[model samples]
Target: MEVLLSLVVGALVAAAIYLMLSRDLLRFLFGLILISNAANLSIFVSGRLISGAPPLIEKGQDFPVGEVANALPQALVLTAIVIGFGLFAFALVLTLRAYRSLGTLDTDEMRVAEPKDPS
Candidate 1:
């Protein structure tokens, strides 16, 4: 299980990095989201995997919580999701503006927005 989890995290991180390197803004946005999810998964897995154990502790019970999931990672993931959504929306709007200004989705051509003033 540990090996599998490590492999999965590695794959996700690699793919996310690859996508982020692409010139397309949309792909970059997606890559950012993917990376965030991968990070969340990595943190969750670091806490160890447990099955069939409840997350909440019983009232008045002094015993330590069972080998269930830690809530911190879950909360962090939720926060990341919201942040990702906001970032994606902003990126989409920026992409739209870029498309409107350049009249093309290709990032390379947009680099030459103004003619080089070689006086």
Candidate 2:
């Protein structure tokens, strides 16, 4: 299970890179989202895979009776998910504004600030 998850994360990162290399602003935005999700997945996989166990102790026990899944990664991923969503929303709005102003989503063409065309 862990191996499969690792492969999935790797694939996601690769796809994110490919998308990020595109010339379109929307593609870059999607790439950023994919990479963020990949990072979250990697962090989650680092916590190890355990089944049917909760990280809790009995009333008289100092530790859990059985091996339990780590909760830190879960919490971290949850937090990252929220943050990623916010970032995505902000980026999406920024992209929309840029498109409205510049009339294009191509990064190479959004060069109004450049004094001279490099071509």
Candidate 3:
């Protein structure tokens, strides 16, 4: 199961990289989302895919009675997902503003600081 998940993460990363390399800001935003998801999945898979009990201990015990699933990775991934969503939303707004002001989504064409060629 971990192997399969790893493969999926790899594929996502590859696709994300391809999209990130494009000149379009929207494509780059999509790639950023893909990469964020890939990171979350990778973190989840690394937490050891065990299915037994929740990480709660008995009243008399110091730890879980049986094989409990790891909670740290789950928590980390959840937090990361929230953060990633926030970041994506901010980036999307920035992209929209850039498009509205620059009249284009192409990074190469949005060079406001660069002087235009006379030719």
Candidate 4:
């Protein structure tokens, strides 16, 4: 299972890098999302995969009697997801505003600081 997950994460990272190198702003944003998800998945896999057990201890016992899943990675992933959503939303809004103002989504064409055809 870990091997499969590692392969999936590798694929996601590769795709994200490929998309990130594109000249389109939208593709870059998608790549950013993919990379973030890949990171979260990597973290999750690092925590190990235990089945049929929650990350909780019995009230009477100080420690769990059976194998339990790690909670830190889960919490970290949850936090990362919330933060990623907010960042993605802000980036999307910024991109939309740039598109509205510049009328282009291409990074090269959206260079307002450098005019292509000078007047």
Number of the top candidate by lDDT?
3
Q: What is the TM-score of each candidate against the true structure?
A: 0.77, 0.92, 0.96, 0.90
Q: What is the lDDT of candidate 3?
A: 0.97
lDDT of 2 by residue, 16-55 (tens): 9999999999999999999999999999999988884888
RMSD (CA, angstroms), candidate 2: 1.5
Which regions of candidate 4 fall more than 4 Å away from where they truly are? 115-119
In the predicted model 4, the residue pairs found to clash are: none
Error of 1 at 68 (Å): 3.6
Model 1 lDDT per residue over 70-89, tens place: 66766777887888789778
**What C-alpha lDDT values do all the predictions have?**
0.80, 0.95, 0.97, 0.94
For 23-99, candidate 3 gives per-residue lDDT tens digits of 99999999999999999999999999999788898889887887889999999999999999999999999999999
- Total clashes in model 1, counting residue pairs 3 or more apart in sequence or in different chains: 0
Using TM-score as the measure, what is the rank order of every candidate, best first?
3, 2, 4, 1
Error of 4 at 90 (Å): 0.5
- Whose TM-score is greatest here? 3
- The reply for model 2, stretches above 4 Å from the true place, is none
